[model samples]
Target: MSKLEIDFCGVKFRNPTVLASGVLGVTASSLKNVVKNGAGGVTTKSIWLKEHAGHKSPVMFGTDHYFMNAVGLSDAGIEKAEKETFPEYSKGGRPAPIIANIVAGKIADFGKLAERVSKLDPDIIEVNISCPNVEDELGKPFACSVVDAAAVTKLVRSKTKKPVIVKLSPNVSNIGEIAKACAGAGADGFCAINTVGPGMAIDINLRKSILSNRVGGLSGPAIKPVAVRCVYDIYKATGLPIIGTGGILTGEDAIEMMMAGARLVGMGTMVYYREVEGFGKVVSEMEEWCRKNGVKNVEEIVACIS
Candidate 1:
């Protein structure tokens, strides 16, 4: 009722609430449930050129206010998703626009994966160079460097006609520079900031780290401020449409990201906490707040902070 539609880089969503990759998107049924519950869009779990078994068990450790995960981009691969998952979701009456989240260790892998998934006709393809749990020679993830980020993004863009959104890593010295490079490399948009840290939690009595990987990426409310800063910086640098993610747990949190310059806000840990219907609840609350404040459309509030 509040005209919640948001258009970004020629792609439009019924609203700004999207299910972030790796939360409820591991399978077709799970993704369909999120859409049925009112997700404006859904980003499938980050897929790779080849299937990965992912990290071991105890991959997730919970903190009082957030979560740390080392899921390691475990996916069924692009070919399987195109053959199995996408067909089911596409046939669902309530299916939301889908964005295929893809990751790879090499530039050629990124291009091949993007080209393959682009045929599935997803609304967008998010190149995931930002996964923090993996090991890379650059010391940080590939998304941390402007050169690597641009290389992956440009390669993918060259192979696909679908809009490409480069998901940026927060574990970087100059996020704005990387963002600018991605935009210049023909990226249609950006999704910031993937997990705030390769943080760790330890069991002092057991003398062991809580997560199997020992270091995991932090998500949820604890990382919200960091995500806001990344979105703000990138917004200032490139003016690209951003899918803000990280620590969104409520409608107010989503609004904060949008006001900080995100065209769409992704909800991950919140959905893990609230389940499928959580998306509708958040959207309803946002609508109420907008109506009472005499807001016309959500986009009018982007970067409204002063």
Candidate 2:
């Protein structure tokens, strides 16, 4: 465990592996299952201030090479999370940190929801300003603009004492600039390259768009290189710990991101690739890689890029 143990924003984790949001993180039981399967930390689905009715089904469609989803930030909402999910996740005072990933429709909603979700006593609060599916309300993902991104971070910062990590969108031209904006707004950390786009998959057979939303965020191995570059650029700009996400599938992929400056590596589409059990599989491979390389502390690799 020595190789896996690491400190992130003053919190301790049994390993560097974390469960990325929006992939089976809908409830306490779902997240608990992630922990049970061996993730060192877990992030809840991006919950909103109120129940959000998402886009119609066919909200997602994909191939083995990549994944596309327009989940529309659908969640059980903050009230239900506080009453049922958060309490259940923390019921036994578990040491593994639970980060409450929150989203909202308006600038004001960010602060309000952050305050409420922070009160649930999650170890950390993640502000999701990157979801591409919310453009109907937000015009575009907040993470796409420095001004909008900073505003959300500043507002959420004012509302919570817990560490606030801003999740960014890969659709932006320069995610590092957005990371800098969040850091300036007092973000304790950052999560990079939240799904890749507003892409469409057409069904030639049915003569229709594959997803109801027409376009969705692209994830999976297809985005790995881009996510790595985003993490590298952000580390250079902010020097803050990063929950590097996007297209991570193997222990090697996790190590690659760590070397690029991620203190914690997030696993999302990998769950789809390898199933929930992928958590343990990836962790074991990480340890095996460390043993082979004589790397005793995984943290030693963060920002080791030279």
Candidate 3:
């Protein structure tokens, strides 16, 4: 088999297929299932400093081409993560490489959450300053402002010994600039192109919105091109390792992401569109493509486009 192993900020992903945060990522049991089914890594759903009641239901809607939700970063909080998830995830013989995804309302809160979770020694710490749906409480996403992005990234990095990956928003006007700011703040890597939105769907018959939040992030195949472009731009600007996400439904889509400069490709909606084991199937297809194309080290393809 062609070698698919790639290292991102010192962590080795068995393959580039990672379970993106938010799909089946609430508890250890669910996360373990993805790892067992052959995900290279798994990110937990973004946890806030405290429990958050998210937006009212009718929170999701989807069709053949796209998926949307304003989950509002609803989470069980870090205490549960420390008590329930990480310990269980750490015990098993097949310990999944966990990337602890964290979100915050204040700049200092990012550091506090990182400090607390850093004790668990997760393989990585992903600061989610990019979540669009929580703007009502969190104000504008930190990702939209280079200064705020830097402050959050810097704070989180200062608090964690683990590799720090700053998740960037696709909603920004210049994602590359924000990425560069995060990089300067000592971000070890980036998770480019969080769901694209404030976009929406209509319920029509009810003469109302499909999702209760009215507007939500647009994900699935609809955002893949934008993801590829964001990854490509971030690579050109920062040259940082990246987990390219958004609309990765097939091995070909993942490969496209790699060529656009992703060291790892995140699979969320694909798991929904296919199944949890869909990660393994995607990796297999990637290897098959690599073999046919005479690609040896899969890393050779990263940023091949520019």
- TM-score for each predicted model, relative to the true structure: 0.96, 0.98, 0.98
Residue lDDT tens for model 2, 40-149:
99999889888888889988766889999988888768888989998888888864899889888788999999888878888889889888877876688788899999
Tens digit of per-residue lDDT, candidate 1, span 128-188:
8888888732256779788888998889989998889999999998899999999999999
- Report the backbone clash tally of model 1: 0
List model 3 lDDT by residue over 1-306, tens digit each: 799998989998899989998888989999999988889999999988899888998877678999998988889899999999898888745455789999988999999999999998889999898887877777889999999999999888888789999999988888899999999999999998788877878878999987888888889998999999999999999999999999999989999999999999998889768888898899899999999999998999999989
- Record all residue pairs in model 1 with backbone atoms less than 3 Å apart, i.e. clashing: none
Rank the candidate models, highest TM-score first: 3, 2, 1
lDDT winner between candidates 1 and 2: 2
Candidate of highest lDDT: 3
Worst 10 residues of 2 by lDDT: 297-306
Candidate 3 lDDT for residue 228: 96
RMSD of each: 1.5, 1.1, 1.0
**Best to worst by lDDT, what's the order?**
3, 2, 1
Give the higher-lDDT candidate: 1 or 3: 3
Error of 3 at 242 (Å): 0.4
